[model samples]
Target: MEGKNIIYLNDIDGKTRAFTIKVKVVRLWKRSNPKKAGETWAIDMVLMDEKGTKMQATVWSNDFKKHEKILQQNECYTVFKPRFDKNNQKFKHFDTKYVLTFNLETTIRKCNNFIGPTHGFEFSTFKSIKNGGVSSEFRTDFIGYVEEWFAREDTTTRYGKQSYKMDLILRDLEGIALKLTLWEEYCDQMQEYISKNKEEEHIVLIVQFGSVHDYKGTINVANAYYITKLFINERNEEIVNFKRSYIGKASVTTSTHRSIGQSGVTSNEDEFLHNTTFSTIRQIREIAQVMHVIVVGTVMAVDKDSEWYYLGCESCNCKASPSLQFPEDDNGSDDVDPKEVLVCTNKKCKRDVVPAVHMYKVSIQVEDCTGIVNLTLFDRDTVKLWGLSAKQLVDKYLQVSDDEKTIPAEFNAFINKKYAFKIHVKKYNVDNKVDGFSINKLVDDPAIIAKLEKKFDVVPFEEFDSMILPTTVSSSQSDAGVKDSKSYAVDDSTPLPKNYESRKSPCDLKRTLEDSNDLDNSYSVSSTKSRKIETKEDIKAQMKDKLLIPKLEK
Candidate 1:
């Protein structure tokens, strides 16, 4: 609906037009240039009209100072003659294809009596998020209760600066759980709330416009760079209704796992195992997408052709494979030769030529009654089965044997041993029709194995080699045969992409209890202070070394 004098947000087309609209500044953030640090590129905002329709608006660097203080978030403003432009960014805030632009002729006037919604939140369902129904190009809102949480991790980033991160398992109203990761200041906000509200039984949290990610075979959600908002146990209608629905539910009980000096792998493995379904080795090969499954298989042989362990970065645990390192100061000695050392392949990692830790990367032939498949066991799961770190085993093997490819006696113990392996089937494996799988976790407990065997039908070990698969078992049939777990667990062992950027906090007006009814409470887990801009010299050095810093996702 359009009036004679005012225009709506959804009515404007990407063309030269003169229009006026009285809208509320739902959210606004300043984007910085990737090439020049601290240089503000544009002031972006999400504006909502009287009809609760949201649209993106932008104020360029030249006009940012003019409207920086004049336009406040959650405040009503009548913007006149704003230009319409196409939204061409790789990552956008909302589904609006066209964005409003502020030119030199654009006029802004405050509207104190404008009747409209202050916030626009379109919450997405767990079913959509779990099945890849939501587009990752745009962030979406999610509401869930915290079922379990891990301790806040205080670690150093590649920049040598200390950072904090925390992981939480969130469950929706339908008993569907998914992993959510909070980084940096977000971690502090949740930790502070937990410390203060230790007696709170149910903590219903809401994340507005959170980025959904699919790591390996697991689907998880995380707060993207500055644009995401958080609300935890707030006295709001949405959260109140959500908490009231789970009043008598025993499954919604919270459990906090303090991982201080404990093995982080145990929690990861437990979450993975709880979510994955049991399948035979033959069923795993027919997977159409990236999926994780449990299979009881016997280790037939250790693939000794490949190295069992690899040198990984000390800080990030990424594989490091740089060229041979020569002595910096040789003193003109010709007798000394260059020593080969493992360097972090991640360009962002500042620790250059540092010591590398030995991490397991063993491949073994695992055979079940259905079929035989190769499984690559990474460090954590390998340590769980071997009862020794890769470094310890390598050291012991080196003391006796010098050949790097030689199978150690310790590793041979896996041969002929039956264990339940959690296999991560990647998209690459499906597309390339590969039978190999990555072992994310392993279970050797006899009681647990017996229970799993009793639940699922398995052929005898004697007929494992001579087993014949049914030709009628299609990929759809295989998937439908197994029980799909509702838990959207995350695989933390996977590394983030090299070009992946971190989040930056956005500045907004903090709302009070008297803000508005039905949409009044929200706590942003972000700093309002400006982030430290990188110097041009620092950027130049990085550019010369081909080590560009990760930029904030806009």
Candidate 2:
């Protein structure tokens, strides 16, 4: 821990176009409910570095598995041989930074500010503060308006202190909502109180300078500091360029306000539930932003500690009884028995979720063009979407399906459920709403499978066998080509009448094979001399007497 160098999350960010530095150790998280990402599973520090720089770090897979050591946050390490991510396509970001590897020689040094900088921004006008939160610091003062405020009593560990950081969702007259992150220190030492506040409220501020991090082309604020002394500027202060903002759910008003318009149609609620696309802007009324997100993948992993909170429906909640379960007192017994429960991670959906113990889960490392992220999936939600119970999958894959076995064994017997998420990839923090992704089946879709069956007439072997028999005779096929040999022609005296005409030429008379009763061969001869049946050679020879043509004699 002695010789380690100091660095920031931004010091070796993934925004570099040519080259970037790498940290020996870094922080990473996996989404807890991958189906809906509100929380994430915090994996202890594994060997990592600023990746957008080097070219040789591609073989980090083995190192990743081998360096699963218990490391602390805010620690620095010495990494070796990180590969330059030349294939910027490898991940979503167009960067020169690379991924690092941790070998046996890696050493970690604990440092302060594990959560990174305690940043602040100062602006001359609200417009100067366009779309607040962590972003590429503006070169000059920008201003906006305090459109809404979402505050709660939250315990965050920053600067070694557990305090509240105010989160403000502000919008300029342009009507775009900005996700604002506040510093915890201000909670203890602020001149104006934001509390006792309400929505549609207005606030003003002035801030100092900050950095403009491209963040892999997604410009955002980082390494930004606030001015200790500032004032509220209410007057029109040179409208700083419209907040460099992107639309997200922050502007999408809650479905709670949706009422049945006079048109006899449910407004936003229907759209939120049935429709797949929608938009929201605080004050801006025109632009109709469209977001299409759909994803289908298996629930590959789960980490319990990463979950935020669990709530069940009072009516449909599968829990034996709906009640809170706090820590046990002396006897290790909670006030209520949480025997079973359904907790939907997507609070807006409010559908009861499956109990953690009863759910199936899986893990997958998802990397888009934007960045790499670890994801977690819930068992029941995956099951509901994919239609594969854990037991069924385990039984097919592992040959263990009976419920009589241990619960874990039974759960493993079935195919885990799958889910899909609609995501808009960007360089910075991700905005995960319930509708961010789509849910779909992990196996072949039922509709397509059914259509194939109809087109190809595919019937199960069992049903086909029942409808047909192997030995049954078919009259149309069995009697084919069996000619009768007892025809009247076989009796030479039976067919010639008194007035039978003479044959036209020797060629007309039968000669070669024995023609007696050729019925079995499918050839029958009726003996009443009719036509001058002759080959073309014979006909030409008789052309001098052509008056008797083959059909004329008949």
Which residue pairs overlap in candidate 1's backbone?
225-503
TM-score against truth, every candidate: 0.44, 0.20
Q: How many residue pairs in model 2 have overlapping backbones?
A: 76
Quote the RMSD, in angstroms, for model 2. Answer: 31.5
Residue range 51-148, candidate 1, lDDT tens digits = 88888788998887677779766667777788887888777878886878887888887654456753577899988899999888888999998877
Q: What is the alpha-carbon lDDT for the whole of candidate 1?
A: 0.64
lDDT of each: 0.64, 0.30
Model 1 weakest 10-residue run by lDDT: 519-528
RMSD of each: 28.2, 31.5
Candidate 1 ranges beyond 4 A from true positions: 1-4, 154-163, 249-554
Best by the lDDT measure: 1
User: Model 2, residue 497: displacement in angstroms?
Assistant: 99
lDDT of 1 at 300: 65
